[model samples]
Target chain A: MRLIELQRRMAADVMRPLSSRAPGVSTYLTPNTLLTAADRLDIYHRQYWLRLLDALAEDFPALRALLGERAFSNLSKAYLASCPSKSFTLRDLGSKLPSWLKADLGRAGKYGALALELARLEWAHVEAFDAAWIPPLDSAALASGPDLRPTLQPCLRLLELSHPADEIRLAANQGTLRREKLSVGTHPAGKYFIAVHRLDGDVFYRRLEAGEFQLLRRLERGLSLGESLAGRIRGLNDPETAPSKLRTWFEAWTVLGWLGE
Target chain B: MPANKFNGFTDLGIGVGLRIPHYDHIFSQAPAVDWFEIISENFMVDGGRPLAVLDRILEQYRVVQHGVSMYFGSAGRLNREHLRRLKSLVRRTKTPWLTDHLCWGSVDGKYTHDLLPIPYTFEAAKITARKIREARDFLEVPIAVENVSSYAEFKMSQMTEWEFLGEVVERADCGVLLDVNNIYVSSRNHGFDPMAYLSAVDPARVAQFHIAGHSQFEKYTLDTHDHPVIDPVWALYAEAVARCGRTATLLEWDDRIPPFEEVHAEARKAEKYLPEAAAECA
Candidate 1:
């Protein structure tokens, strides 16, 4: 067989489930004194899966907490089987996990939406934590010019999730609030417009109103100040009173340095 | 020690892998060390703390780019985006040379993220050589391939490991980053004389050397770069220095890393084996 075919088969063999015995020694592998051909190959197989599985659990601890250890490992393994790593770095290993969780057969219905949101929230934190850093929009520029199109910081990530996943993350990170036995997959689903940003090398999240989220989203897409406000005005809960709310959100976002240009 | 055969590449003494655990000490204390080698993929992103730290580190240290993800022997196209990012890093760091493992990592667009072994056949050599040459031309820098420790050997491999490595580097006309610890680990696992393995390579083609520690179980040894270099591995490094001269040597400590002084002290251990490094130490 060609080299690629051999590699594909070897990778498949290594990624095989652990329940089975060491896979039949590939006709291609040479047996040595200490290890049979199969035993040797099994090492890589074990290392590859376990390393990635551990990485996943670290990245999405809430998801693990929600699903329990066994279910999470099994689900992550299946997720990995479908979405095996394609990035050069392991940091991108869980890039597809939120979507993978969304597509899971056992989950994705109303009851599973909280779990899916947790996965999305965790991945966003990972992405936002190291995102590009940009200086906040100049306070002087804001006072002087109304035509400014301030850009979002590279580290800034705007997430519209189905649940308040930030609450769980914040609680876990602070170590202040947690249940004795936080039951798996039991949480009320709620909508959120979260602005995940980095400050002084630490990541923080701000909960945004509907109008605020719409305005930030528009600004992120390169919309000018007037245009973003125009879009926001139409989507506001109280359009007539929105001018003050718009000023408040814009000033807060600008002060947070969520823009570059 | 004689100069390496590769032009413009000089003996850079001993260096340590720029690890995350040492970031605070590196930035604040600005520890004195020969040089630092960074895993290229970790800094490939557009913007972040990693880049900021690397930019600052570049100002202080002679940085070299060591990659883990250029699946050179893959049955696929060179990842153009990955190459682009790598070249960008090369320009920023002004690394004299670049290196990655001599193994394929992905298949059919899926990455296994491991330094897998390959067969030692003429066909694999020819194709892999072409890819390496292409990488060199496009990246606009000289490149080399590294030997990885393996638990399994391909029965279909027609030649020994050293012969296969020599074949690939010779055919590709690239340089070699000979990891002495890898040679030692493989020698123990495969039951081969490490000297014979070192003897097979053309010394002139080697542009650098790597010494690291490994985990030894009852049956086999795994190249886990967490421990300090053991006695036998240091001996093998001494032999490699004898043949390859004062090639740029890097010490890697990836896991369970110690403090900056400890890691640097571990890397400095290479100096005892490398004559020029020993003199510099004196």
Candidate 2:
């Protein structure tokens, strides 16, 4: 057989879903004394799923916690089967997962909305953990009114979620979250604006007020100061106190190294 | 002594894989280790903890980049973005030479992420060698291809693994990161004399050696790299050192890793095998 053809066949054989019957491996593989061709091929097949599954589990521990082991395993298998990695690095294995979860909400059942929010938050954590670092715009730089064109740091990920996924993920990290304790009664529907950002090589999360979230989202969208605050922010009820509130948020952002030029 | 024209042949004696579990100990205690072999892919990130930790390690030790995802035998052009990120890392670490597997892991742009065995045909060898050479030229660094411990062999293979390895390396004009544990694992699985595989490799091209552990199942030995270096693997390393001279050696313990002291003690055992070879290199 030709090299490419053989590789394609072997990759297909290895990547065949584990539950399905083993592919015809004896045709391409050589049998040995102890192990048959099928047995040998099974090793690679198991490794393929195990490696990708393990990587996804590491990246999405919160998702795994929410879905529990069996469901998460099924979701991972289906996700991988549908979206096998296309990147060179395994770090990118979960790059499309949030979108995939959003697209396949039915599979998540009762935990669909919460699971989707958790997936988005987890993916944001991954991005914030390793997104490129840029020098922040210092308070001095922000003081220059005429030339103050601020941008959010690359390592900052602003997420608008319908559930408090960040709190669950923190609980999961701290070993305080119980799978049994998670329920719709426990976590009522609530809107959350979370900023996941990296600072000094550590990832952190901060809950943002609706006005702050809107302003930062606008700045993240490359809106100038005039444009970012020109329109009334959706949750900013009092326009009289908006200046002081915006000033406080900008000061906090500048101090946290979240603003870049 | 072997020529190792790859990078003027520096023998970095006795190193362990830079693992995450040992980070606090490594930073706080600052042990007197010879060097570290970093999995290149782990640090191939845009920025953040991986690079931050790597920068700290670089400040203290000589770090060699050993990669697992090059997939030289994979058909198609190499991923340009991967190479660009890898080159940036190479520039950062200033690794003397870089090592990745001589196996294919991806096909048709979808990565299996597991190092899959290559059919040892002349055509496969030709393609793999070209990719290795291309990567070497682009990275502007010496490239060494490591033999992976594979379970299955291809029916279309025209040569033995050792012969295929020789053909690829000779054609590519590259160095060999000869993992002796892989030889032991492959030997047990395929019923080949491990010594024959070792002796077939050109000593002059050997740039480094990897000693690791494997798990024995009823049918085959898997490259687990979680246990201590078993006796047979150590014996293979002894023979490899005898043949290849005192090349750089690294102990790979990826799972169930012990404390830094314990892992370092396990790596330091290479000194027993390197006495004569060390003198020869000197």
Compute each candidate's TM-score over C-alphas: 0.92, 0.97
Encode model 1's per-residue lDDT on B104-149: one tens digit a residue: 8888778888898878887788888889999999998888789989
TM-score of chain B of 1: 0.95
Q: Give DockQ per model, in order.
A: 0.69, 0.86
Candidate 1 TM-score over all chains jointly: 0.92
The candidate maximizing TM-score is 2
Off by over 4 Å in 2: A178-184, A235-239, B1-3, B280-282
Candidate 2 per-residue C-alpha lDDT over B200-233 given as tens digits, one digit per residue, 9 for 90 to 100: 9998888889999889988889999889999988
TM-score, model 2 to reference: 0.97
The fnat score for candidate 2 comes to: 0.86
The ten-residue window of minimal lDDT in model 2 chain B covers B1-10
